[model samples]
Target: MVAQEQKSSHVFDLLVVGGGVNGAGIARDASGRGASVLLVEQDDLANYTSSSSTKLIHGGLRYLEYYEFRLVREALIERDRLLAIAPHIMWPLRFVLPHSKLVRPAWMLRAGLFLYDHLAPHMKLPKSRGIDLRNHSAGKPLKSEYSKAFVYSDGWVEDSRLVVLNAMDAAARGADIRVRTRLAAAKRVDGVWEAQIEDKRSGETSTVRARAVVNAAGPWVARLLSDELAVPHSKSVRLVKGSHIVVPRVFEGPQCYIFQNPDKRIVFAIPYERKFTLIGTTDEAWGEAPGRVEISPEEVSYLCESVNRYFEKPVSPSDVVWSYAGLRPLYDDAAANASAVTRDYVLDLDTTGGAPLLSIFGGKITTYRKLAEHAIEKLIPEMPVLAGQSWTADAALPGGDLGVGGFEAALKRLRDAAPFLSLTHAWRLTRAYGSRAYDVVGAAGTLEDMGENFGADLTAREVDYLIDNEWAVTAEDVLWRRSKLGLHMTQEQRTKVERYIADRQH
Candidate 1:
């Protein structure tokens, strides 16, 4: 039976299904445009593919080989735009691509770099240049055979935090964000969509009315369309599993490595969590449920072998401390190889017989903002009440208001305000929350005032903030998504956190 109290009588202009980057971004954009929006997620925000990305705001450099110039240029532009808007969570990083004669010739590498640089002329990042690995700092951990490299610029993002920030911004703009809520079914009712939503935790059902629906369900996009919405989509999504491994720091450098495999696939080795190196991801075809995806033993061995091929210190499966896998719901373009499939997104607007249903396919993290803008544009005819302009491009996500002085300035201000906080604690908070770090820290004047320490600088006060503001309900939500403190905490510490959150909920 439907819970009468949970039912929403008010009709939202748009109902965004999915709470990943794309969905959150769409809700933020649409709500900012004065459209009443309701966003529902089956799980915590960025609980899957969004958080499991390579975590780079980069143009798919390899896509240029496939002649995806438009996607590359758009991603390149978005990279800078993301950096400018969220300097605290997104910032510039230099990438070192060691030239392999066995993979590609120097001329081809140079040419690719040239195109990457010139693709977005207005980009503020430094241009790519050749470097002799023999004398460079980035070559210290590499084998002596790798004597030359090409360095270029890209941006790094706190992938999960980016999603949460967008949701927060949308909620602040009066959008209703419902997490742990599943979209059970939907049917067209007199030219409008009446969606049945279920609270996963309570087993309670409700109904919501909307003028339009956005299917940004990522891996579940195809299934949701066919099963729930009853919409026949001719276009299909190819689910490819990408896996990553986290190991002890491979090298002592700030630069990341883009290694080329003999199979023509590339793997990235990036510094992560300040103490570990992240290397991955293998592109293998997946046919299982997206949520059940996990890195296989073969994938671990492949990744270890991929890194061992270059580094002087061999990496084995034993060296891996953590590993994760996510399925990419790429648009099936009939490519012979999974890696050859286009990384660009495709939007299909269905306005045939009833209300509009926009299904998003094959989008990358680097271009989610643009994807949202385009999604809203497609719905403008259905929602003429929406503002005539796109405003998200110039707006900042929540906690990302760094002001004109940038990240360092924001960090300094946070440190000065909270003299009780240690340098490491203050820096982490500033990086994670930007100007809003003060909100989490609050009026605490001493360490004890921050409440229980669950290890690795994760205070109870921060946990409360996440629960009250960010919709974090469990220890996993706090440790993994709200922040990656799970990487730094022991099993005992994690259990304590779980117990604490459970007690609080009770």
Candidate 2:
């Protein structure tokens, strides 16, 4: 099971341990700056915390309550920047915060919305405004008592696709990406990082040398620093478990609802993937092992009750179509309340040891790009040859350059070229692949050319494309990470997919 080694002697300027959003983002930015980079992940890209997020590229309006104005402002700027670059996957989202006078006064809510509007004025996103809950379509699903609300602008991102597009861009820029490869250990040797990497799939291992190593392991950051690198852990990461649930689409309109709870932690009910509504997330201090973190019975009930209290249509366990849990690696601040802990990221670089191991802790998905830029800035004095000002600010992610704008037009073109594709199938492909939909459907005039049907809309050709290009190594990777087909596909279909992948290997 050894990884097909790319010549042992080929040295790298930077070695990144993790293929989550931050790691892939760092690799993309660093490699784009002309660094010889290598990014390794022990599992499929975005298969962990990155994919488990609430799936928004928001500025975190709630952070303002903790006097995190700076964090909120910076994230607001990033939200606008990401929308411009990855318009296909990232776009503007309007959040309606229905005011329940019992939870928080309307004046306090007004002040918050005022700051949210002016926080990042340089951005293209819309400003916040008061909404008459009874008149607005966004309030139709809400209970009658919630008669007033504030609507503010933020951004929504295809969380997992963001990681994939970043990794794809990094690879296209010449960075080496290794999936299912664990960073076993590392030591400074002759002023360079001599790291041992093991392939988790086949139990094969190899050693590599790099001038610098970045540990952006998210929830596993502390373990990577203390256990893998054998380095003294100076920074601590508090694992906060957040959970989300998907239910059959409940409300109409593109606007998402934000319920301000008495505990000060907000719950979001967002329009998701056309046919589903995404709601979440409960923030609780986690003392359990990181790997064992899952949505608890209490959390599920809390979320359902919170939503039911505000909405006309009550949400119960029976309405939940899917549920997911992710642990946020917050930089420990000794805050008594889990909700009060800062979500800001911190980078600790140990160049004093001759070789540098930069450990990243406590960042939100909204600010990963800026985090990557700041990270590379810290390494400039050490790796002087790594050139760059910042280029990612305006760059488009893979399949993101939808040149004109609407992906619907692109879908129309795809339909013209491949008339056999069903309307739903064409829409899915266009949204997923963007302009590259043509390459996927290339010369296939009929449904038969799509190769074997594995159930749902998944076809053999798409699976092969994921394996060859996206580093999809298993059926779960295809179903869960690469696509949400697992939600719709039956258990029998899932088994068939597993067999297809295994039989292909044989």
Candidate 3:
């Protein structure tokens, strides 16, 4: 960590505001190119929109209909690159899209899949194909009327961990990362950006200087510009709330389903954490603050109804074990319907009177790396000291260097080396930390050496690693973001973990 005094005293090449995927990616990219960077987040990493995604590294299949060919093609290509870099956190998943003659015609579906397949022609993932649902394993859980389905491949991600990984890589590359630090104000002074940042935990405020600023505040982008920097941007963001619900496993297979709703939106039911089914996402206009966004009663009903349309068994609000909502800061294009808004990002570079401030509007996780590369390209003319060329394209994120052995082979090696660990526990560690799992499991020959088990295989040693390395302070950061142990733990167990974190802080 960069010392507080040093952070305030030194002038950085870039000051990245917001610790979501975009900001983290930019910090990592800039630091890799030899630019001095400091990134500040107002809350825990991925505590907002980044953690609340549907957890897919997918090319927006539906976006093709909106004529967003460029975005789809870019995302499709990125899917392969992400899979190669972080095989543990990201992998290919087959999506079962049941055909509804009453809705989209068979020809239209086929045409869309064909375009999707050819868009990224070199992608090694399986091509889309029609399946006989009556005889397929995916069919057994669906309604009897659905006899045919379309299966296509996309990627799933550990959403919050992805953000943490990028931040980790950035820090490793010499970028200063500060979580729970809020940007209070900024002004152009003597051809540089002078900013005041407040640490939310300690109530300490400090001033930092930077050659440039990046507003990757996700939902708070526009507000940060107007309120903190007092700069007006011609582009505005539309906050659309998307909600997801988790219930007990609804199907027997590993495959996920993409169901078409009567309202023309789609919802996904994916296998989650080996014990639950994840279903989601309703797009609705939101005017509320982005922090701590919650799923509405109506959204719960909407998700349940959407899944029930295809699944044999129905689910209701009572069946939902967990639900979360996030606000997407989409670039406002004056589209009439919330669902019609484009997912493409727009970068506004403000060099109005003095130092430059780059504001990012609307971006999905699938294309964050490319977005960062583009951001650096735009800033290079102003900041010529930024090293030549983009380097993140082939670089591996922290703990993602599994070599040619790959994730499965790495998992086998982990279990083999840690004979004392149960298969489930070892698997969990491998999935969460990749090659760095050994670092967490270090020298412990027995379960007793792991220290205080709060529940669901969560131990003190793992928590310490998160605290010391990943900037995890609260139990919620451990249970929810760094890992999903909360879903498996009881309230008493959670309370115990919370107390453990509190005790360690003292």
Writing each residue's lDDT as its tens digit, candidate 3 over 254-321 gives 89999998778999999999999999889999987767788999999999999898989998889999
How far residue 282's Cα lies from its native spot in candidate 2, in Å, is 0.7
lDDT of 3: 0.92
Q: After superposition, how far is residue 496 of candidate 3 from its true place, in Å?
A: 0.8
Model 1 quality (TM-score): 0.98
Model 1: per-residue lDDT, tens digit, 1-506?
44543677789999999999999999999988899999999999998889889999998899999999999999999999999888899988999999888999999999999999999868899999999999999999999999999999999999999999999999999999999999999988988899999998888988999999999999999999999999988998999999999999989978999999999999999999999999989999887777858899999999998988899999989989988888888988999888998888999999966799999999999999999999999888877967568998879887778876888888888888888888889899999998899999999989899999999999999999999999998999999888999999999999999999999999
Least accurate stretch of 10 residues (summed lDDT) in model 2?
Answer: 1-10
Q: Per lDDT, what order, best first?
A: 3, 1, 2
Tens-digit lDDT track for model 2 on 236-261? 99999899999999899898988878
Clashes (backbone N, CA, C under 3 Å), per candidate, total 0, 0, 0
List candidate 2 segments past 4 Å from native: 1-7
Deviation from native of the Cα of residue 447 in model 2, angstroms: 1.7
Return the TM-score for each candidate structure.
Answer: 0.98, 0.97, 0.98
Q: Where does model 1 exceed 4 Å of error? A: 1-6
